[model samples]
Target: MDSLSYLNKYFLRYKKKLALGVLFILISNIAQVFIPIFLREGIDGIQQEVQYDKLFEYGLLIFVAAIIAGVFRFLIRQTIIVVSREIEYDLRQDFWAHIQKLSHRYFQNNSTGNIMAHATNDISAVRMYVGPAVMYSIDTVSKFIIIIAIMITISPLLTFYTLIPLPFLSYFVYQLSKKIHKKFTLIQESFSDLTTRAQENFAGIRVIKSYVREDGEIKNFTEQSEDYLNKTMDKVKIQALFQPILYTIAGLSVIIVVWAGGGMVIENLLTLGDISAFVIFLGMLIWPMIAFGWILNIIQQASASMKRLIKILHEELEIQDSKATRTIINSIKGRIEFKNVSFRYKNDLPDILDNISFSIEPGETIAIIGKTGSGKTTLLNLIPRLFDATNGDVLIDGYKIKEIPLKILRQNVGLVPQETFLFSDTLKNNILYGTKNGNDELVNHVAKISQLDKDVEGFPKGYETMLGERGITLSGGQKQRSCLARALAIDPKILILDDSFSSVDTNTEEEILKQLKEYMKDRTSIIVSHRISTVKDADKILVLHNGRIQEQGNHDELVSLGGIYADLHFKQLLEEELKELS
Candidate 1:
């Protein structure tokens, strides 16, 4: 019950429609109860042979009342169920949006499949409880109470015998609820594993096929499926055992009513019409009882699912908007500065970047060069405030980066990451995706700069050609070029390219740098690369070693010093020359 408090708020939101559904059930049940009285009157009237037209009139009135009750029943479902669907829609959107707000750490801790299960299966289970299960449970209980009261008014002795098994059924339902909730939770978790496996396999299908592990994949799926199947069987077995017990007690009550009530009729203690009405009341009670068991199943499932969803909503947001601090400046001049900053993804582990301090003037190109894992990309990521530093501050002009609104700051900063990701859409759409208002001319200009114009020309449909997932249709170099075009389309004030030209050859890379220089004057640009050729002509070169700036100079100054920067430049030159000789 404590686990279900969050769901109760949504229930309250749709309480109006629920009240209407209950009202309709009340009207329907009243009409149904009247039929027993009408039947008794017609029976007694026919036997007495007094007023034949009166019986026909009474019967006609009964039929019309029943018809009207049926009409209200349809109206109840239409109104209340639609309202429930609205709740479902709202819940799913919030759930998805919350998932997006959660930290990257959450993704590292939880499986993709588990998160997906909460969105799809868990939400669906809650929907069933919200709409159908809630309406039916209310309808079932209300009808039983009203009908039973009417029966008691007619004959308390008959009601007593019929209700003897109800206490046992109540206890049975309570016990079943505890067990059902536990089992359903297990079943849902098993399904989460299964869904995760499917998602993982689909996303990594290339690896599986290349390795020829089709049989291995099948066996893994089968094991997950078996666990899910067993959980379901456990649920069914409990249902199979309990449903009969509920009905058997209900059946005994009916048999008891006939044996006891029929003898009363013979002894002149009850009449035939009274006995008939009592039997109708008993019959009315059975559907509600049977439905009670079904409702329990829904309630337990919904409870489990609702709690699972709330777990996500309850997570503390990692990247929260600073409420205590307001922006000191409205706009920035794009002068980027990094103070003595130190950062590590892990608390105990050594720093990925340590005591790094550098500044780029308003309109200059500064290239970073390092070996792999030397914090070249990490340094670029810090400027956009993707992950906040453990110490020190990054300032744009005079304003701290954190003080700027994320939206405004990111709009001014464009990053082309090491791994290129593209949508499965036309090449034109992917190229012009940086800014919403990007024009054809802007896209083509960037495409020429990245040397992607030739790749687009080779395609049968030119720029309109559709690429596969992650731009699988394009070669690695072409994909990077397309990604470069995307960032360039934004026309950002500060551009950060983190080893983006890794896949492109020297000639194409040279052409890209040449065109980029013309288009991106007066705006700050940071290039991160290992090849000294890429950053040699820059205003300044930053050489990072184990997350610290070991050298900073122009190409000539760094070469003269003969430190880490000079050594790396010579090593790269040697490698290129050796490759040519070989």
Candidate 2:
């Protein structure tokens, strides 16, 4: 659907207010038209040496008309402008809510700054057109129609002369509208680029400082700013010509009316009072004409902004439940299976997991050990359906995950990724991020199991301590533990820890694992780690190499087999011995 159709629905939601606003505009314009009639009577009375009381009455009538017009104008703004603000609020909130539901892949393709521009600049532009532009456009048209009808009754020939130049103005404005829309669209695109550059620089400021590339980044940013300025100037150039052309045509119309009407007055074809009122009415028409040009500019800019917003809103949701697969399971058994699953992020990319298969029964602890690029983390992500396999099926409790509702499947699974993310909120809030109804007892229990309780004890406010952006105030191990506590707070049936313990010391790791074993007794646990010690005691160990499972067994069995798992264990043992000798 077009922007107009979408906006029409929003407008209809406030139809009563809009109708009232239009009525007030009509009243205001009618009152304004009466002012010219009062001027005509007052001039004719003064010419005839009329009594002072007669002139006073004419003056009073004009004053009353002006006051009524002003009051109605105020009402028009209160109704229409307020409704536009309400619609803008609804649109922006819905935009943000829709953005939150989009998949991780969507974010991977679109930058944060680009999306932010849509919410801020684009929304603001749309509001400008919807509110003031719409209000004034209606006001202008109503005023123009009223004044033109009055002038025609006074003298059709004079009115025709005044209106002859209007068709030219209309043609010029139509041409300018198209140009303005194109230029404005380009300007918005350049603005997006500028915003993206600034956002990247701010987010990567630490990297810039570490690499001593601050000057280079600033230079690059300046170049982007220059490009934005140039595009803005281009748009300004088009707009600069708009008003002058409109005024020129309006001026020609006035000149024609004055010259032709003056001759009529001299030849006794028209009275001086009639010509006086006609000029006043013609003068009133100029504002509406000029306002029409301004309205067109606003509309063109809004159209460009709306088009961008609609593009993102219309994007296909790549990761949503199908119509027939909206089951909300009451409980999850935590049994997981990868049935010959092969996967890649994109069709052209190499398969991260090739024809891989594995199964973990409920209440089993499975450790996955693999090299850096062996799809260890990717495999864990599939369990929660963060990304679906390109081929084959991943099932939980003998049911394909795609058939299960996303909320039900994800709610039962807890994932602690290697790259932990913590919001800039209190430690307590971060720990209970994904859970509902987080109580003190649950928070403390999960923190203790994740070895975060001891750290919280030393904090200034315990669990209430506020964190900096991405939890920058906390150490790496503390952040990881905090995230682990968060996942545990949800009381998930399936827990997948993807190198979650890398930052903690071995003693702390052992302490956490000791507590976790009891937690895993009734839940399914999958640990992906590079450290052999981290997963040595798991019920089953699967060693992956180059996107395929190289071996699978208990620690002692894998050691006896003398494969990749055995080789990794022996190497880690040698490293520990060397460290001891040192």
Candidate 3:
């Protein structure tokens, strides 16, 4: 949607408060207009020998009008400013929801630090523009128009003389606002870079310390901080220029009004009251002129921020889901097939997987064995549609995976990625991550199979132990087992253990694999492992080399064939024996 249209929706949501704010500005300015008239009337009343009682009544009326306007001013703020905060709340929420709906590729390309800045700082800037900035801009413009018309009506000659410096004020404000906007954009970008640098250091602090690079990191951070400082100074210097310039112009207007109107009053061409009203009107115009510059600054900053947000919000979804998908079968038989699939992360790069074909029957165990950088994880990722293949289709139960609803497709497919992440919560909560309501039965079943039950019980808090972040964290092996338990708790039709046991002890691995064997009997299981012993018993095994299938068969059949898979199995077997002897 267009940015203005998007902003207008927010306007409509809080229109009542905005209307009330404008009413206050109108009432306040109008009440101010009467002050000069009251002073003029009092002067004329005294000059014409008016009665004391009559003059007292006129003064009382003036005082009552001021009080009434003050009440309106109070109402405006009470109603409007609070609504501004409410609009802020809504905008923040919608912005977050939009980000969540974006595909995983978006997060891959954008850093968390950059996204965080947009959600917090940038959005707050937009909110300010919407609320106070919006109200005051309209208020200033309306008041300027009202005051100028009133001054002209009182005496065109006096008005014309006073407004000679107005055009210069506009020109100065325009140029200054443009410069301020450019500097502000630079400042925001610098902040993003600084945040990214700080976050990276924090995440890899152990490596930094181990490598004795603390001084280097601090130096890099200092450079980033310095750059941010320079950008902020630039913004402040430019934006500050206008405030003093605007105030000077206001002072000039006052000087001109006094000089010209003093001559008219002395010449008897204007009343003392008329000249008084003119000076008051000029005084009133001062605030709006200053606000005009401030409003221009706000608009420029908000426009720059909105453009940055648009770039992300309008980004294309790399993987599209089907709209005409129906419910999946209650119990999937777990047959998977890949037909002549070719895939690449970018169009400019060479294909990562080229024309690969594979099929696995129901309730069968298949091991995908490959070395690092051999497209092992890439192939597995395609099953759950982390990315769409460039060519051909992947099917489960004779239905194209892309045609099925993502919710249904993912419900049946369980994946344990290499990096195991757990939220900052209790161990039991982590184990039951997506399985709402804390399913103890399912949690305990998976924990036992993953051999995490023993590990969890060893903790003082047992299953209820708080883990993650800097809390009472577990070892790498324990964490992996907890992740495995999480995946298993989902009770998926197709279970994929992707290097899930790499960090565990040999005895623990043996026990987990043995338990997984029984679970795999009536389900489709795909295991990716570097250890030969982990995959030697699979019904079928495939060896992948540089994005292509090099060998495929049962472990014994492949060993007899003496290809890549056979060589790897024999090498691992010899290595194990050597270690035992030592």
Candidate 4:
């Protein structure tokens, strides 16, 4: 109940609709309450005299009341139930928008399946509370109040006797509701685990098949399914008691009405019609009692789900534009500078980039060559502010990266990472993904420069070919080239190629670089690669070992220095000579 307070704004947002629904509830109950009264009149009149016209009149009145109640009942659902769906849509949209703004670290910590469960199952549960639970709660309460008030007016003592079981019913439901809330929370958690298992298995199906672990995965998934089933059964067992307990309590009240009302009728203190009306009124009370128990179940489930949703909604954004950001500066010339930059993912971990200081001039092409774990990717990430430097400053065009607006900073830089990723979309759309209104000419130009034009031409649909999930339909080199074309489509001021050519042959790499040289003449370029051949002709070459720069020079100067770069170059030359001899 406390957790559900977050939805107060939504309630207020649709208060007019809710108010109309309440009005309809009141009108429907008002009409329904009179049916018992009309029954009493018809029964008494029939005993007094055999008058068919009078009897027909009472029947017609009862029929009219029922029709009115039914119509307004329909209106109640149209307003309240419809608003629930509207709120669900708004809530889902807000959840997705917030998720997009969350930091990359948030995704690393949370599983995709868990988030999906929250978006689907949890939101639906909350919608039940907003819709059916609310509607029925008002329906039950108003019906009870109107019926009980009328019953008391007819005979106070009989009404008192009939209501004796109500206090006990209330106490029983309160205790059961606590258990329901606890069980429901466990059920939601188990459901999340079950969803996560299914999602992971599907995403890694290829890996599982390659490793011949299908039987193992099936056994594991079966265990999770059984666990979810058991948790649900436990909740169902608790809920199953509700109907019988409510009906038993309602039955007791019915018995009391008959026993006490019959005695009064024998004494001539009450008529046959009064007893008949008392019985009809008591029957009306049964639905309210049953509805009370059902509403409690819905509330408990909704509360549990709302708590989970609130946990995600309350997560703070790790990186966002602040007051210090310079919003007026919408573009950059791409003179990137790292002033004693140092970074680590966490405080306790050793630095991946330790006191690295370098500056790239507006048009310079700088290449970083390093061993596998040499922090090359981490350095490129800082340029886009994907992760900020833990110490010192990263600047663009002499402005601190933090001072530049994030959207503007990122738009000015293009990055093609080592691991290529593509959406399940057309090749043309994938190539043009980075630009707002990229024409086919731009797409074709970038595709040609990245050497992806030849591959696209070979496909049956050319640029219209739809890729499989994560571009599984394309080869490794094709995916990398597609990613390169996407980066080029942006026409960014600073271009970063982080081992992006690892899959392509040396000839294709050479051709792409030859075209890139002209395209990058006025834009700053950063290349990170392991190949000596790749960095040999750069304006400047940087050699990194561990987390620090070991050498910095052009190919000839580094070879003359006889350092780490010279060793790598000699090894590559020897490998090439050996390949030619073979």
Best by lDDT: 4
lDDT (CA) per prediction: 0.83, 0.87, 0.81, 0.89
* Full ranking by lDDT: 4, 2, 1, 3
Report the C-alpha lDDT of model 3 over 503-536, residue by residue, as the tens digit.
Answer: 9988899999899889877788899998888888
TM-scores vs. true structure, each candidate: 0.89, 0.91, 0.90, 0.92
- TM-score between candidate 2 and the true structure: 0.91
lDDT of 2: 0.87
Question: Cα miss at 516, model 3 (Å)?
Answer: 2.2
Which is better, 3 or 4, measured by TM-score? 4
Q: Give one digit per residue, the lDDT tens place, for model 4 in 453-513.
A: 9988889888989986654399999999999999999999999999999999999999999
As a whole number from 0 to 100, the lDDT of residue 140 in candidate 4 is 90
Clashes of 4: 0
Better of 1 and 3 by lDDT: 1
1-582 in candidate 1: lDDT tens per residue? 456668777778878877777788778778777877777777767767778698888789779777877887787787678877988998998888898878656887797767877888888888888888877787787888888888878788888888787666656766776577678778978887898789889989999999999999999999999999999999888867777877787778778888999998889887777887777777777767666766777777788888888878998876545763345555566899899999887798789999999999978999999879999877887887767788998888767777787667877887899999888998889888768887779878889888999878778888888887554388899989999898888778898999999999998999999988987798899999888889998999999989989889999999999998888889889999999999
- Residue 126, candidate 1: C-alpha displacement in angstroms: 3.2
Worst 10 residues of 2 by lDDT: 1-10
Candidate 1 lDDT score at position 512? 93
- For candidate 3, list the clashing residue pairs, or say none: none
